[model samples]
Target: MHNGKPVVLVVEDSPIIRMGAVDLVLLAGYEALEARDADEAIRILESRADIDLVFTDVQMPGTMDGLKLSHYIRDRWPPVKLIVASGNAILEESSLPAGSRFFPKPYNDHSILDAMARMLAS
Candidate 1:
C-alpha cells in the first residue's frame, strides 16, 4: 500500500482508456499501477504483493484476454479483487470468476468507485 492507501492495477491496451482509469483511481485516493496488456499485468502481479485490486479491459492485444486473466488471478491470487470492463463483449455473470465484478464500456465513474470501495472494504 502506498501511503496506507489501497493499490489498484489497471490493465488496458489503449493508452487513452488506461489514462482515464488512472485518473479515476487517483481521484478516489488509491495508488494506481498501469499495464498495457494481460502479460504485463501478470508480470506486475507476480512481482508485487501490495496490489489490493485489479481493473482490466477486455479485447487487449495479448494471448490472454481479460476473462482469462480474471480466471488466472482467481486461481493464483484469490485475495485480489477484480473489476473487468468490456465495450464489445457480452459476458454473463456466471462467466466471471467468483468474487469478480463487470462493467460495460463507458462505465459510470461513481458506480465503479462505489464498487471498488465496497470491494476493498470487505
Candidate 2:
C-alpha cells in the first residue's frame, strides 16, 4: 500500500484508455500508477513492492501481452491481485492466473471499482 491506500498499476497501450483507467482507480480511492505496455508495467512491478493490484489490457505492443504479464506476476509476485481486460480476445477461465478476474471491453466503472474493493479486502 502507498500512503495508506492500495496501489494499483494500470497497464494499457492506448493513452486514452490508460488515462481513463487511472482516473477510475484514483476515484475508487487507490493510488494509480500508469504504464503504456507490459514491459513498462514489468519495470514498475520490479521496482515497487507496495503495489496491491494490477489492472491491465490484453492487447499491447510489448515483448509480452497482458496474459503473459499476468502469468509472470502470478509466478513472481503472488500476493498481488490481477484484473485483466480485453475487448477482442475471448479468454478462457484457465488461461488466466489463479485468482485473477477478467472483464471485457467497455467494462462498467462501478463493477471494476467493486471488484477492486473486494480483491483488496481479501
Candidate 3:
C-alpha cells in the first residue's frame, strides 16, 4: 500500500477512458497511477513495490495487450491483484490468472469498485 492506502495502476491507451478509470480508482478510496501501454505499465510496476492492484483495458497499442500484461504481472508480482476489461472481447475465467476479475466494457462503476475492495480485502 501507498501512504497507508492500497495503490492501483490503471492501464489504458485512450486518454478519456484512462482518466475515467483513474477517477474511479480515486473514488474507490485507493491511490491511483496510470500507464498507456504494457511497456510503460511494466516500467511502473518495476519501479513501484506498493501497487496492490492493476485495472487494465484489454486492447492497446504496445508490445503486449492487457491480457498478456496481466499474466506478466501475475508471474512477476504474484501478490498484485488484477482487473481486466474489454469492449470487444469477453474472456473466460481460464484466460486470466487465478484470482483476477474480468469486466465487460461499460461495466458498472460500483461493481468494479466493489470487486477492487473485495480483492484487496482478501
Candidate 4:
C-alpha cells in the first residue's frame, strides 16, 4: 500500500485504455502505476512489494500475455490480487488464477471499482 491506499498496477498495451484504467484506479482512491505490457508489469512487480493489486489486459505485445502474467503473479506473489481483461477473448473462471477476477473489454467502470473495493477489503 502507498500512503495507506492500495497500490494498483495497470497493464495495458493501449495508451488510452491504460490511461483510463489508471484514472479509474485513482478515482477509487488507490495509487496507480502503469505498464505497457506484461513484461513491464512483471518488472514493476519485481521492483515493488507494496502493490496490492494488478489490473491487466489480456492481449499484449509481450513474451507473456496477461493470463500468463496473472498465473505467474499468483505463484510468485500469492498475496497480490489480480483483475484481467480482454477485448478479444472471453475466458472461463477456472482458466484464471484462483481468487483472481476477469472482465471483458468495455467493462463497466462502476463494476470494476466495486470489485476492486471488495477484493482489497478481503
Candidate 5:
C-alpha cells in the first residue's frame, strides 16, 4: 500500500455528484469514500478515522448542510483537511477558515486534483 497517499471523503447529496467526485479522486491515485449527506459523511469519518481530506458541497437537501458539516469535521478532526465545493455564492462570498479550501462548481478535474494534491501535501 501507498503510505503517503491521501484518503478522501466525498460528501454530496446527489448520488451522481458523489460518484463523479469519487471517480476523479480514484483516477488521481488516491483512496476515496462517499457519503450522500453530512450525516453519512460523519458516520464514515467517525468509523474510518484515517481520512485526510473531505470534499463537500455547500448546498444540500438535508438536516446538515456543507458549512455545518465542515464545522463539524473541524471540531471533531482538527487535523483533517477540508475542501468546500459548491455553486452557491453564499459559501464563496464569505471567507474560509485557515487551512481550508473552496472550489466553485464547474471546476476542472485537473485543477481539483491538483488542489487535492496540495491539500494532502500539507
Candidate 6:
C-alpha cells in the first residue's frame, strides 16, 4: 500500500509532542494518525493495515510502553518502520532493529524530519 508517501502513526500521550510529530509528518507530505496512548495506537494499527511507520514516545502512561509497542509492531508487522523518542537517551543501540531509530526528547523539528525522511527513503 506504500508506494512512496506512506502513512505514519504518532503514538504519544503528550498532546504537544503528538501534535509536533503529526505536524512534521503532514509537512513532509505523509498522512498521519495520532493516538494518545499505546492502547489506542494498537487499536488504530490493528484496523489500519496501510500504516507504514510508527513514532512512539517511550514513556507512556500505560501498561505497555513504547519499547513494548515496538516489539509488538516488529513481531506483528515486520514491514512497518519504528521510531522511538524519549528522555532515555542512553538506550542500547543493539537492542533495536538495525534501521529502527531512537531519539532523545526535545529533538529539533528539523532533525526529526530529516530522520523521518531517511527512514521513509529506506
TM-score of each: 0.98, 0.98, 0.98, 0.99, 0.89, 0.91
lDDT of 1 by residue, 2-117 (tens): 68999999999999999999999999999999999999999999999999999999888989999999999999999999999999997898999999999999899999999999
Least accurate 10 contiguous residues by lDDT in model 2: 84-93
| Model 6 lDDT tens row, 3-121 | 66689999999898788889999998999899988899989999988998899988898879888888888888898998888876546778775568888888788888888888877
How far is 114's C-alpha from truth in model 3 (Å)? 0.4
Query: Which candidate should be chosen as best, given lDDT against the real structure?
Result: 3
Each candidate's root-mean-square deviation in Å?
A: 0.7, 0.6, 0.5, 0.5, 1.9, 1.7
Model 3 Cα RMSD, Å?
0.5
Q: For model 4, how does the per-residue alpha-carbon lDDT over 1-122 read when each residue is reduced to its tens digit? A: 77999999999999999999999999998999999998899899999999999999999997999999999999999999999999999999999999999999899999899999999999
Clashes (candidate 1): 0
lDDT of every predicted structure (CA atoms): 0.95, 0.95, 0.96, 0.96, 0.84, 0.86
lDDT of 6: 0.86
Question: Which scores greater on TM-score, model 2 or model 5?
Answer: 2
Model 5, span 12-63: residue lDDT tens: 8888888899999999988988888898898898888779989999888778
Collision pairs in model 5: none
Off by over 4 Å in 1: none
Lowest summed lDDT over 10 consecutive residues: which window, candidate 4? 37-46
Which stretches of model 4 miss by more than 4 angstroms?
none
For lDDT, candidate 2 versus 3, the one ahead is 3
The per-residue C-alpha lDDT of model 6 at residue 4 equals 64
